[model samples]
Target chain A: MHTSKVLVHNRDRSEIESEENYLPLNVLRLSKRFGGIHALNEVTFNIEEKSIISLIGPNGAGKTTFINVVTGTYPPEAGMIYFQGQNITGLPAHKIASLGIGRTFQLQELFLSLTVLENAMVGCHTRGRAGMFAAGLRIHPAKADEKRLREEAMENLKMIGLEQRASDSISSLPLGERKLVGMARALGMRPKLLMLDEPVAGLAAHEIENLVRLIHSLIDRGLTLFIVEHNMPFVMSISERVIVLDEGFKIAEGPPDDVRANEKVIKAYLGE
Target chain B: MKNSEIDRTHIPFIIMIAVIILLPIIIPSAYIISVMVFVAVYGVLALGMGILIGHAGLFSLAHPVWFGLGAYISGILAARGWVSPGIGIIVSAFFVALISYIIGAPILRLRGYYLACATFALLLIAQIAGGQLTNITGGHEGLLGIPPLSLGGFVFQTDLHYYFLSWALCIGCFWFCSNLIHSRVGRAIRSFHDSEIASKSMGVNIPKYKLQLFILTSVMASLAGSIFCFYLCFTVPSFFGFHLLVELLMMIVIGGIGSIQGPLIGSFVILWLRELIHIYFGKIFPVMTGEVDSIFFGILIIIVLIFMPRGLAGWVEQSFNLGRRTYAYFKGPGA
Candidate 1:
């Protein structure tokens, strides 16, 4: 299959060696089939720390399915996943999250009843070491931890330009601000890897521009980002590498420039 | 809508604690003191219910099972000299927590209508046990000679003394539940209420939090029940019947579900209304009867539900927000 397709700029040996400098996150022979349909078929990829990777595809192209598998939302029927050289296959979503994987939903799932600060506090659950009894009783350690947590939450909110909205209930926030809050919550978890599902989808161009800047800021802070997005321009501008899938099969893999020019990717889109 | 300047969360608690503490001094009657004592007891029970229903958003009416079980357990144990009042109270709370954990394990797995029905059935079963188990429970006649709770040589015999004791316990419970709602567990409970799937995905063990809240609330309810039995120096299985269960449930609703103030406000409103109607109508207008008061309270509850769906706490919060707006308006555009 590799020979049948025209080789589109495969990495040189020196470049591949340099790329492997950081620990590689491995998705091994992953396959997920729902009855007669295969959402992801024997797809394998490696993501290194401090790199921005984009998963691009047409509708029903299993971009989301791949994200789900990586994030442990969907347990792969056959495969292994290793994060930082440790096996994380078949771990539950929250366990995966606690293991330094953070995620934002396609549609934001916020604590509508709680204030913005409180919503971010929920994300700090894993980092908290206070026992429930101690917290309930407001013991000295619990109080100190709470003060630190509130400060951390505030710092994250400030980072997202939402410090003023801290006490405001999340239900009242606009969609763009809510998206920012979701990102802030994920940030509060102190993740080594952050997966964002369409962070700028359904936003105005200006909002999308703002989100692009925010993503870049997070990347600058040394967060590994895997973004699933439909806005090709936004993905192309920031993504260091791109993986294209069509009908659950890897169609092309290269730099954004190469992937953008690939005939197979163009054909997959045109066929839709 | 972005008025995040003020912290109004604890205002209701402050006002409530003030009103309850000053109630006896203002009322100035032995009979009224007795009524206030009952209000404090009701406050304790409602506070427990408030934690589960208000904070955790678990719709349960199993107050009587916990309350009655604690009352009977502590009463029987203390009366038999198995333990002193202090130890018995501690043991009662512990036993209630244990029982709630066992019962909640099975019942909490069921949600919505199934949960309500299951707990309702549990209440019925407790009521039946109270009626049929004559040898141990004294059946409908109830257990008698429940010794008064004493800290040393000092027993709470008078309504004045019991009222102080009850309010002290009420304060302790209020502090505990308030602190809990602000804790990580409290947030987890609220998280489950808001979004169970999201909570699970956040590394919160859903069943563990639910059971923890259930057991905690159960222990609180039973502690109140045991204290009530001790204070009255009399116990009857019927004292913790379905009627009391409904009343306790109504307290959470009338006060405001999910708000900490709901239970205390609900208990006062309910108990006061009942007493007012009982004294004035039953004594003066004999034909009105206590049954009329039940109907009256029912109408009031319906009205509250129709107009103020968020209950009294919501109303107070609305007005408080309005007050802030008015203040801002008076401050003018320049300020």
Candidate 2:
């Protein structure tokens, strides 16, 4: 229903007003090249605030490369990324993250040696202000800060129903649970936009359902989600808008039903 | 559960403190006391290396260079009566900290074996500088007659006095390190170690944390070297050589790489084993001489690696958990 309100690219006052009211992320003329191969070629898009969107492409369609460039894992050869209407292209990964962008890896990158609680607490690194000296001396304010950090981490774990397993080592958790932990950790950053790379890739049907429900709850809380996933049914069911990519080209972009009906998307998935 | 975890972690630290206090009273032999003093000195150095290698996962072979620099700086200052031994320690620590930051800024950017090779090159360069800078270092003949550490009226002259002083300093360093490892920065260091990508995504500045830990480790190593110089009332280039570096590395590996108690326990184990091997092997073999100790140490380390890959602290922790589980099993679920 919210996708119906998305403005088409135009200079009209009504379109400008709609863009200003909802747009949180805008990537323009993003391009990345590896030697002779163009991994991403002049791709451009904008994400509305608090909207759940899915990016779907066949293997090697530059989906991962696009995410990497946007998140500052790899700098785009040419492009500008604007978050909340400010230029943020080519910043370092940590700086980008501190600017309210959080991401999870395709293969879960949980701190395996640390406990679930600690892994989530690490996500709260940007929020805490206590320095090494303050922490080492056990300064009263630092202690209180640490207490608050723990509570916040716990609250994040609870969001994904993982607070009960907070003290368990990450290595002890199952794959599905580990993915949830990764999501919880990202949530701990309190990011305005959460980017998930293949969040439901290895989950069972029931687990996928649970994750979809959790994601819906997160969207309801005014958090925007940019999901890159291969599961078309799940993506179509949950994402208000779906963007299709084919070999680094933006082939289709619209509401899920409209994009599903596009011949280019069908050809991209079924092959030429 | 939180209270119980804190109590469990503190047990080893409390036991270590009790052992340090009881050792001099129980032994009282000057030879044994001096040997224990060496353990405390080396333990401090190993703890520094442990923080670098264990927490940050950086392999720095140039630790002895900082250690040597600390000793030579303190030795030169004390010999000239420019500053007291207390001031010497603080001055040398800051000096090393500054140098390490400058060096680490570039070096910490590198990863794995490249970083190791770069640091190793630094060690060789420092050793050469020690010999070539004859006016300052005294070259191969070594700096001598550095005055005993004293505070106004009291002089730390005897082995017993130095023993308590070194252990006290060692304990203080341990307390600082333990506190640091539990702090927010420490968590960031460990997270970076486990997953650099994840840590960076969580807004942890990887290079900044690595360089900070590197500087901290260097400062601690320098302080230990200063105390070691005062303990012997002299300094030597040979004291801060490749052999000592290897010994410091062995202490961390043998004690348990990441645990707080690992370096301290490792220093005691390696030093005691070396002494025992030297004393007994000389009498038993008669012909093998000093070579037997190295051969035995090699074999012992190999055996330790094969049996306990995580090191002694890990083994101790595993057994501690096993004990707790068995006790709970006998007590039943509700009890």
Candidate 3:
């Protein structure tokens, strides 16, 4: 049986501990099995606030499974997930999201009928206080709340350089711009932890560059980023630490350079 | 789509409402006004079903059940002298909301065909009860003597009077539904229509939202039913079964499924078409009965699906946008 493997590169910055520096995401021995196959087995990691962490692996690696479990898309078969020190194991997707975990899909699951701004407004549902009665009747508080949400959604679109496209329907947007719209929608949630699954996949070089810049800007705005990407240069340049997985196991863990050079990770990606 | 004051988009809706208001006065015929009242009642049903089927991507055949139950509740209560027709309408809406909420919690979890089947079964069961529950419902003899709705010394006794009430109910439902679709709740419902996983990732409680929509639409149907009962002053056990459900579906589909305007338009067309069928086709096809009605609608739905897949509302939107485009083209860029 393949148990566990961890290669830690203890940076000097870990010594500078403070009350605000507590780990925002901590996954311990998380395991998810899809029938006879182990999508993720005993995967453990922690992410600090305001830093970018990349999860890289081969085609069958459990990066998406990890995200699905963390976001409560699927109940983990084993282990626990702690977000801001609260045990969020097996919570419903919406409950976990309300606790400040926002995610963008790899393939982009935008609301096709809504405009870009309206799509972002859907992301602000948890922050809304208006019920069906109030909204149906267009009462005062509901109107005020809706106005605030629209402004918030507009702000997010502006942050992602999509204010011009706010009125455009999402299905009409190009793939790269749609990816950015996905980011803008997620930003509407005001999440402390933002997870982006393959933000640069299928994007042109210029779009990738824009995304890289936007990714850094997100960290500056005080968000912790968890990215699953195949673009090595983008991941290596952006990630402070990179975790590698293969065959449902954590094969390598450290800075991007170390993982790039690791024998096991090289074998996992290239061949024996 | 912005709801700002003096929005240009609202002009058409305002004009449409104006037409509705002036319709009875302009026509001056008892028969036309009577048909308009039916259109208004069906308008409420279709609007409720429109939001569910078009925006939310849900299918349920139980709308007729909600409408029937509402008519029965208000009619039975008022007939028994237990309450006023006004209070009965209120109580009927409340109970429909509550009953649908509880039933929808489990039933709404079933998606697509399963949901349709479940709701259809519910309609059948309620229809059977209306026929079987003899002592209370008057059974096959039908429930009669349902008094008209009154408000503080004002009694609605005439077709013209009921026409206003019914149309007001329909327009009011449209106003609320329109506001809802453009609001946070509306977007939340539409979000799941395309991508459930994406909506869920954004912290949308899918089941909760679905159930809430189910409840709201059920209440709308109930109101339509309540109005129908009072307008007729009688309701048969066979009323509001599959035929009524198909009529509501036809209204939404013919008008357009997604836009509230589509169904509003659809309800009018359908009621008028039914009148035509009754006047002309009823004379020609003397052998026609319940079976012919189904075939008529089935073929009508197929024709609409083939030629006007988006329905009349969609066609209206397309031409509206096209007109705007042409105007802008002649006006030049950035005008």
Candidate 4:
């Protein structure tokens, strides 16, 4: 319901009102190229603050590249990314991450040998302030940061219903659980925007149900979630809006039902 | 096995302190005592490298250079007679930290084999500098008249004194390092080992953390080297040479690569192996050579990699069931 369009571009800085309400993320004509292939070309979309939006497309539709560019994983050939109305394009991945954007890998990139809680704690790196000296000495600030990180990580694991297994080795968890742990780890960053890449790519029906519930809970907690997934039913059921991409271009964008019924989206999925 | 890796680093350290206190009293044999002293010095060296290669999964062959530089800097500074050896060691550490920062900033950009090779080249260059810089290093004859470490006017006069000092320093380093590894920076450094992408997305500044750990490892090596300087009362180009790197690599592999205790345990194993070779294989060759240690180290490394990639320390950690029982026993029924 909070879905919006890109309403401002190349505007004079003096005229931009600080008091105006803004989307959490806004992108303008993002483009990426690998040699001759246009992995992403002139794609544009804006995510509303604290809304659940789904991005879906057929294989090789540049869904992953789009997310990678937006999250600063891949350098865009040309584009401007605005996070909370500040230009974030061309920033390094960690810099962008520290600016309140968190993402999970398509293949869950959980630290395999560490405990689940530790994995989440590592995600809270940007939030902590103790340097090597402070950490090594375990001084007041360092101790407090570490203690706070543990609590934050534990809180995230609890939020994801994984506090019981917090001490369990990450590798011991099943794939679905590992993905959730990855989400919990990303949550440790306490990002304004949390992006999930193919969050339910390989989940059972019950796992999907659990993930849907988790997503809804995250939304209820006043967090924006940008999910790149292929599960049409899951997307339609959970997403307030869906943006359809094909061949590195946005084909349709609207409420999930409208996007689902759009002829362009149908053609993109089933072909002409 | 469940969580021993995190908890067990301290157990060996405490046991090592007890051993450090008891060993000099029990063994009293000068030659064996000196070897144990070598274990302490090299143990610190290995701990430094362990953080780099073991926990952070960095490959570096340049640690010996840092150690050598620490020795020379501390030796040169302490040799002046005005500054205390303790001050000399501290100054040497800062120098090594600065130098490592300057060098690491560029070298860490090269990943895997390239990084290893860059560090290897650095080792060779530093070795050459040690030999050629005669005015400063005193060349092959070694810098002479370097005083023993003195604190509050009590001078250490013998190997026994150094054994206590070196092991004490080793214990101190271990304590701080253990604290470090349990802290947030430690987790950040370890995160780089498995998932750079995940760590990056977590807002971990990978390059910064890498360089920070690099400098810390170098500083630890500098500390060890400084102690080595004070203990020897002289400096040599050969003390921190290429062979020392090979020896350190063997210690890391044999002891266990990642954990803090790995290097200390590996240092003990290698030293014991040296003593064994001296007892048994010394008769086979009229003149002992570095080649001898190489053959033994190469074979041991292969055996370690194949049988237990984690090394002896890892093995100890795996069978820490005995340790847990002992710990539980000491703590009482409820604890």
Per-residue accuracy of model 3 over A159-197 as CA lDDT, tens digit each: 889999899988789999999999988988899999999
lDDT of each: 0.81, 0.86, 0.88, 0.86
Q: How accurate is candidate 2 locally (lDDT)?
A: 0.86
In Å, residue B13's CA in model 1 sits off its true spot by 6.4
When just chain B is superposed on the true chain B, each candidate scores a TM-score of: 0.92, 0.94, 0.93, 0.89
Q: Higher-DockQ candidate among 1 and 3?
A: 3
Q: Give one digit per residue, the lDDT tens place, for model 4 in A142-245.
A: 98998899999999999889999999998789999999999999999889899999999888999999998988888888889999999899989888889988
- Model 3 lDDT per residue over B58-144, tens place: 898898889988999999988998988889999999999999988899999898999999999998998899999988888888998
Q: Which ten residues in a row have the lowest lDDT in candidate 4 chain A?
A: A1-10
Docking class of 3: medium
The digit string of per-residue lDDT tens for model 1 on A209-238 reads 888888888888888999888989989998
Clashing pairs in 2: none
lDDT (Cα, tens digit) per residue for candidate 1, span B228-287: 888887788778887898788788888888788678889989999888788778887698
> Each model's TM-score?
0.87, 0.94, 0.94, 0.92
Q: Report the lDDT of model 1 for residue A208.
A: 86
Please rank every candidate by DockQ, starting with the best: 4, 3, 2, 1
* Model 4, span B85-140: residue lDDT tens: 87888888999999999999999988889999999999888888888888988888
- Number of the top lDDT candidate: 3
